[model samples]
Target: MGPVLRTEHLVSADQQTGEIASKIDAALTQLARARQIQRQCLATRHGLSPLQLDILMTVAAGEPPEPSISLLARELGVSQPTVTAAVITLERKGLVRREPLPPRRTLVRLEPSGQPALADRPFVDAASRLDPALQEAMLEGALVMIAHLVDNGTLSVARTCLTCRFHRSDGGHYCVLLDLPLARSDLRVDCPEHQPAA
Candidate 1:
């Protein structure tokens, strides 16, 4: 016979809620600190805003599709005008260039100047400057939460492992794109190869 279930072994709703809330708060705090560090680094070292840096990195990644205004807007979950504004600012800074396509569309690409900027310290590296254990815990929790939110459609700009087309689950979940096994802890909220599963 199957093992009998025990109601007493289950966690109470209040306990679960408290644990989830605490974890979320801790994760969010760490993420905000990391973002702050990144923003400061970009502003001080590169004379760029966080949005500008994000745009540059997205273009450099070259995933989902080519860097066009519409595509970028959709990927970033921002208005077309917001992306256009950032593109124009980046163009003025000589970091990005817009090439006119047929009809009314334009393609954006990073210029030579932008290449060096992307090589600078990223937030994850910056986070390492803090307490190792704290950083690791915060990042791990944040990744899991973000992945959950993305999978549930609460977050628009992230791609989750479980929802990607390349995800396989024979014995364990794995990504065929990378040809590597995936541990539950290894899942990411932002995988470049992630294609929305049909």
Candidate 2:
């Protein structure tokens, strides 16, 4: 028979879980601070605000049916006026263009002239010595965290499988749109093809 857990043992286990959770929270906080610093540095170096850089990065994808001001506001979790102000500045700098769409809506598109900085990814995919399995696990864990954030309204947008209409997972991951099987690594954090599950 298996050894029965006593009250003290259960309490000890609960404490351990809390302690581990605290440590993970602390580490995440450090990462957030580092990200803020990186964003500030990059934004200053390129003569743009952090919000402007983020907007540019989002639009740099150059997807069809270009993002409108309202969509950008919703995606970025910011007010419409804030996004509109940023878009105006970006347009003045020739980094983006405001195109009129039907029914009195304006869409945002990249200028296609300058913006060498914003077009490229800010964070380099640094070489890691971690094993492939460990790396994949890390990626899966991060996506799971992102999904949780989206659920709790900490994040406004996440074009990931968790909310994607095309994703299906009975026991395995698959994409209906592409009609393709998805390995854990095949999952995308920010997919251009993502459509809301609703």
Candidate 3:
């Protein structure tokens, strides 16, 4: 049985609320499209394909599964051949190198020359100008959306507090690993300590 709500005022069938939700969805889509276009621009500027730029950025983020072709394929949601082909292009450009690891795995390593592609993130630059309060609120909401995507299997991975094993919502927001209560502003989107919840 579904739990009861304290009031029916916010139900989705309400015209105003439904319209607001639709607007929010459209805004999010535009935001994503804008970011993708910006990345494509940046890719062209640096003479790299968007896929190569993504591979470099993934390596720079340093969160694991450590950038093997198969790992990158899964991480970037592309096929192994596609990642291999892109990696070849990146390698020829001196942006990355292939290293042999044990158990017959090939590790893709970003080189110093690859740094330029990972630099100049337009969204990060723009978001940095937001006021602290707005930044925190945006981050909190983004984590919630990311968590929802992960739950829906739209995203294979997220290293955010919402998907972490240590997040406790039984009482107030808390981090068991940190042993601290979280204010909305204290919520983290990509914590180094993040461990996925089972």
Candidate 4:
């Protein structure tokens, strides 16, 4: 008898495309759901909207000197006006303050009352509610992604700093980096490690 031959069915190009489209749709749906859940968590426990909470957390995590409106906006991926509005709201609530400082900027810091609200058991417990392993993994992933963005210039490491506005240079040489007076002309220069006055 002649050798028997067998043929297998193959997916058509349209079928393959449909499968990919379905996967993308599912992924988007999950992302939307996750964002909604996070928003609800912030609203229910913190008595603040997600944007409000973000503004508070941003100020809380600022460097010892605190951060200005422009710097905070850059860090939070929002516009200056958006940050300004949040700052105004926080100030009215006595949860933050706008201090007058060098560069003539608005500095933000969490008030004493705000600290307790953020540090309360509910807040801490809500944060702890997430799976530790998952949180760690997400943090690692975010770091890696941020590194890529920085390298690509999609994100900047050099924000407002000594050269930007906050740094007040007196006459005579003074600098941990160059051991010389930093000229005002160098303001536009980018320095990743620049530290501005608090």
Best by lDDT: 3
1-198 in candidate 1: lDDT tens per residue?
A: 999989989999999999989987897799789777866686668888777888898899876556899988888788999999999999999999999998989899889989988776566576778886776566556655776776688877656776677888886778899999986657666676778776
Clashes counted in candidate 3 amount to 0
Poorly placed runs, candidate 3 (over 4 Å) = 1-13, 170-172
RMSD of 1: 6.6
User: What's the true lDDT of residue 59 in model 2?
Assistant: 79
Residues 83-134, candidate 4: write the lDDT tens digits. Answer: 8897888788788888877767878878986774455334346547778775
Task: Name the 10 consecutive residues with the lowest summed lDDT in model 3.
Answer: 4-13
Cα lDDT for residue 109, model 2?
84
Q: Which pairs, if any, clash in model 2?
A: none
Best by TM-score: 3
Error of 4 at 139 (Å): 5.5
Candidate 2: worst 10 consecutive residues by lDDT? 118-127
Residues 1-198, candidate 3, lDDT per residue (tens digit)? 897777755555578777986987899999999989988999999998899889988887876767799988988889999999999999999989999999889989889999867778678888899998999888887888898899999888787899999999864579999999999888877688989998
Backbone clashes per model, in order? 0, 0, 0, 0
TM per model? Answer: 0.68, 0.79, 0.84, 0.50
Model 3, residue 182: displacement in angstroms? 3.4
Better of 3 and 4 by lDDT: 3
Model 2, residue 30: distance off in Å is: 1.5
TM-score of the candidate numbered 2?
Answer: 0.79
lDDT-superior candidate, 1 or 3: 3
The deviation in Å at residue 68 for candidate 1 is: 0.9
